[model samples]
Target: MNTNEEHEPRIEVTAPLGERYDEMLSAGALGFLADLHDRFASRRHDLLAERMRRRVEIANGRDPQFMPETAWIRQDLTWRVAGAAPGLEDRRVEITGPTDRKMSINALNSGARVWLADQEDATSPTWANVVEGQLSLHDAICGILSFTSAEGKEYRVTAERTPTIVMRPRGWHLAEKHLHFVDRQGRSLPASGSLVDFGLYFWHNAQRLVDAGRGPYFYLPKIESHEEARLWNDVFVFAQQRIGMPRGTVRATVLIETLPAAFQMEEILYQLREHCAGLNAGRWDYLFSIIKTYRSRGSEYVLPDRTQLTMTTPFMRAYTELLVATCHRRGAYAIGGMSAFIPNRRDPEVTERAFAKVTDDKRREAGDGFDGTWVAHPDLIPIAQAEFDAVLGERPNQLERTRDDMHVTASDLLAFKGAGGEVTLAGVRDDIAVTLRYVESWLRGVGAAAIDNLMEDAATAEIARSQLWQWIENETVTAEGERIDVELVHRLRDEVLGQLPRTASDRFDDAVKVLEQVALRPEYPAFLTVMAYTRYLGETPTTESTTQPETPAQPKSAREHARLVGERDELPIAV
Candidate 1:
């Protein structure tokens, strides 16, 4: 490990370094990260504690309404966020993917206006991925990224029309255990994943990006409140000042994913006004947050199957419409949610139907005045762009179309009562199937899975598992009059495991164990990835030694893997 002899606070990397890892983790970068930790880590802790306190209040029937204290911020309409920084003006379509080498090239060349190079939901936080993803982003920024497949097909970033690169760091809830920082008490604490990602990226490439006519743009994920937005804004300020750049050089677009965040869109944008780009309607995580927040409220709050919860539902409509109006009112862009459909290569009919659905989804967003939309796959890019183009035409955006007709009350946002379609046996099976498969892929170091022609990520798994827990907790009866109890879930789980394809049996078995533990428990875990990280992926500090065990004495389930790591600690009891 390399360290600066003169710096007081040094970054001690517990993870093994890989090729080019040193370049990204230099003393200067690590020192910047440590400085961020020292300045803001305690505030991050307090904010997380605030999140828990709020959740408890909600559990005690304290409904979330617009904060009366921040009423003036919302009522006042003269303020607007800073205008778009370089390379962020015309974001009609943005493609999102992990920052692996090939994906970096494909997404940048995908013809979308912006590429959300994701280190968050779309990436498994393996140590190698954490380090290598930064390397990929750096290479892409310098226009030196290229890849040759094992079959010898070369891929490179096209020189013509490359999309603007906007990095999405991990959320504030997570910690980077691989990077340790010593506190004043001489004790070690995990570095904030958010800081590590943002600090490293900013330290390495902020100037280069600015020199290349783009600023260091980001997509802030999983923020629950405006204070969280304030934390990010403060980080942006410190980072720019530390690196000797302008104050608003770092622009960020916050993802309105959590239900609480949906209610505070204006406040969030207000807090980050100088550094804000806009807001994104993160459809899947938003649903997961709703279910998680209100799971104990009985059937009125119980969501139906994951498949039935479309964006057109009354509650979802209220959320999105309010977001568009809020953004336009504040003079910011309103970006739509992801269309997760991946075209089926073999079946033209399936591809056509999927494209049609995507077209409708994007058209609705365009007509409702969204400046842009998100697509997971390259093929869907043109489909989404065409819809946005039909609405945008020669204009860069439709910020002039202020959606004054929309007014979303708290009750309308909470009107999930019977809005989603009825739960059914097929939905139960699908929930189990998709959750298991997704968890399996995640264990194998893949975060995004193309399951059944849809791009399923961590959010998809969260919604699926949350649905199971909600159903079982509420004793929700399926359309066939079968109660979704623990027994039925276990039965379906075993049956699904039995039906798994031969090649995937071992991984599928591991996935079933994970799904059962998370979904069938008496209390719902806040996030499955958090627990799974402490279990399977936390074995080794780095990816070099942490690849799956070659020969195991027992079945390599996530639980077994945890045991292999000598971690026998009981799962934390949910509050």
Candidate 2:
């Protein structure tokens, strides 16, 4: 336990402190995180509640439109976000991965202009991972991060020009249960994961990074509204002031990944103008958000196979073009989404096809006026960079190429007609298998996995399971005229399980159970990870008593607590 100011609350560490964890979780850092929670946690809660309320409105047939109230902000064409921070001015290629020590070093040395060290969808939030990720960033900044594989392959940061580091913290809806803070009324609350990640990173490395000619940059993820973007802007302001740094030192790139956010791209950038660097077309999660937002509307909004929904699709094109037009109009870079293809050295045909697809995707983004794009693995960085290079020969970015001809409307954004592909029994089986495998891996503290040569993360699983749920709910008829139903899904699941090797039977079975609980329910869970977290990662505190003590008894250790809870009986499968 660490105490802050006499009037301020103290933070209790319920997780076992590991090597270097103490260095990152010092008293001052904890105090800073606590301050952020005390000030903004409630607002975060309210914003999430508003998300649910807005979902209800959409369910009642209120199609999302650009806000009339924010028309003044959108119409003000003279305003622009702050110019790019040091080392961020030329982000023609950026690589993304978790901030494990090895990954931190490799990404920094990946030759891309920026490395998106992720703590969100690409990371599984085990307690160790959360704390160690912060430590990895700290070390990477100090130029001491390295790794050695089992075969004695030593990896280090050898790039003469390393990528600028931009951290992506967790979203607002999640809480850092490992860290506890007391509120004014003597009620204990979980610290916002967003604050814990941002506060610790900024507190320890802001000055260091600034002195190194780069500052503490970020990628704000899973935001739904300009108000949410405003919340982050305020956070950056307070954190900079709290640490005695300049107000604009913390730069952020917002991911316009939600359906509502697609409509408010300009508004989001406007809200974070002073701190905004750019916006990313977070394409995968954007797809999941579309399905989740319109799940109840009817069959018209239901999406097709995730494989079929390319960036060139009408709705997707509308979203990307609108993003580029909005961003470049405001003097901010419009980054394209991730190209989740990992090269296979042993299979030249697979590698060649993947490279061709990556080349086409990057070429499309570059030609469409995007400043840069994301690559999952280092091997694909050169492929993406070459395309961007050909388009942007001398210029660092295409911010000047504002696509004014892109006249996207609400209908264009929501146009899913002709995009649906054949949904077969094989598709159903694949979805079940991928969703189950992903959930199982997520529970075991792995967030990014390569399944069938595609890098599948939380967003991929979200799309997989959400498609199944949407198809079943709509009784969507497949290409063979087989309508999706609970019985059909079950048959597919069983058939997939039967084909699995005996060694993986138990794990696959548990995954099936989890998929049923989340995807097959009468109502869709907002996030599959949230449900999986409660069931496997950490236990939720009791909501029965209102007048209880501010801080509950501490758990012996986070690992032990997780073990006990994970052993609890699994949720019963829906019949």
Candidate 3:
């Protein structure tokens, strides 16, 4: 070698991974990984692909899972109850009376599937007493799990969230071996952007549930985007790989409240196709946000009646429509959001009016296409379920109605009304799809058996392209202005100064009766009041870390079904 005198030039190498690059890496070609492979053994190399295999499951903004089931059979709720189990931890409000505390062991025993004991930011009690109460809760859950149906058959019962008790690995193993993996956790989990990896706590815990014999159910909170849902899927995949829960044993319900999420509804629905139980209305934050959303515009839209402001507005309509479509498209249950803070006892008049309102909501929601709705109070259970029962039995047939509505076609015609069939740049329209979405929602409650115009399979969103052969058709729905407007006649009738003979159900007859109840000026003084109450729950807030989820670790189909059947048998409970 000629050294410096007559030397060959030496080349310097730098890695693309910057300072973190390894000397073992040989090439500068890789963005990062390539260089490592050159120095490392080929045996360690593998492609990083998505865990679910590269099958893209969504199509034209819909999940394949949301289709109507061809086979029809009614499912009974036996070992379960379907209403909110009041916050055992809800210190802001108390359910205690001379006869009962807001939530009771009897209610837990009354076939509720989820008894959400209060754990976060509620109550007033000593940590020790709360811990003791949790121990009691654990015992109660154990008892419930051991409970049998009226037929005296043991339905491998699984209890939920007794107290946030930590399980020694062995106790966890034993409990899981006995009952289902439990639904033992609840919290706001208030992360701003997204939730932690579903796999972070998901896989380890799900394996525990799978081992213990329970299906997995989780309530994911603080969700703000569709990517949050993807994260859930990723977690599920990892959990499945570790614990062997089937692709869908685990289920989750996202609380819909954050404003950004309202527009991302489709993506959120698609992202959690297999796992979603549907969305719920988180009222407190939503109303608070409404104030913020309208602060700049002022409160011109504010309603005098709070009830009138129910999630039943235009935005609610759009949000629910997308939700129903997404759920129906994916063959999942499209649940209606909450009607919260209603008084919980069953007063006949209150129940009747509540029933009517709920029916109307269910009907309207059904018209918009929702499968179920939430009733916040224990007392509202009967009314809510009865309303839903009317619709559940008819889904298979009404699904056909949805298909037919999809057939209404469109074509170019005069943008404005004119002589018949004059072709213009204006496009014809049929809102049957929009209307049928509402009809389908009503059908989901009753389990009715009827079939009409139900074969809804179609290949295109363009109404004309779908049935292009119809190349020419034009129609407009009857606008309200087109309806009859009859005025009182000054002319004498056939009988001379007489009106049509009245029947008991006649409109004029009913109006006359209503007029008798009020003076002509009609001032009985009916005005709604908005009030706030600072109620105290009898428990103190302790760091939730002291409490841990007590879910079953194993999942068994038979037991789960039996448990659900028992759940269905009980009247829906309210708190």
Better of 1 and 2 by TM-score: 1
Q: lDDT tens string, model 1, 378-494? A: 889989999999999988899998889888999999898858589999999999988998988887788888998899999999899889988987789999999999899989988
The backbone clash count of each candidate, in order, is: 0, 0, 92
Question: Lowest-scoring 10 consecutive residues by lDDT in candidate 3?
Answer: 525-534
Q: Is candidate 1 or candidate 3 better by TM-score?
A: 1
Q: Alpha carbon lDDT of residue 342, candidate 2?
A: 75
**lDDT at residue 502 of model 2 (Cα atoms):** 56
> Which digits, one per residue and each the tens of the lDDT, describe model 3 over residues 1-575?
32235222111222132221232222321112221212221111111011011111111112222122311111211211121112211111111100012233434432322333322101112222222333333334334323344687553323343221111110000000001111112111111011111222232244444444443445454344565556655555545654555776666656555444554554665677666655544443343333222211212322222223455454445455555554444444455654433432335565556556656755665455555554434455555555555665543212222221321111111001111222121111211221122122211211111112111111011121111101111111122222111111111111211333545533332222222211111111010000000011112212324422233443353223222221111111110
User: Where does candidate 2 clash, by residue pair?
Assistant: none
Best by lDDT: 1
Superior by lDDT: candidate 1 or candidate 3 = 1
**Where does candidate 1 clash, by residue pair?**
none
lDDT of 2: 0.83
For model 2, the stretches where C-alpha displacement exceeds 4 angstroms are 1-7, 150-152, 502-507, 538-575
Between prediction 1 and prediction 2, the one with superior lDDT is: 1
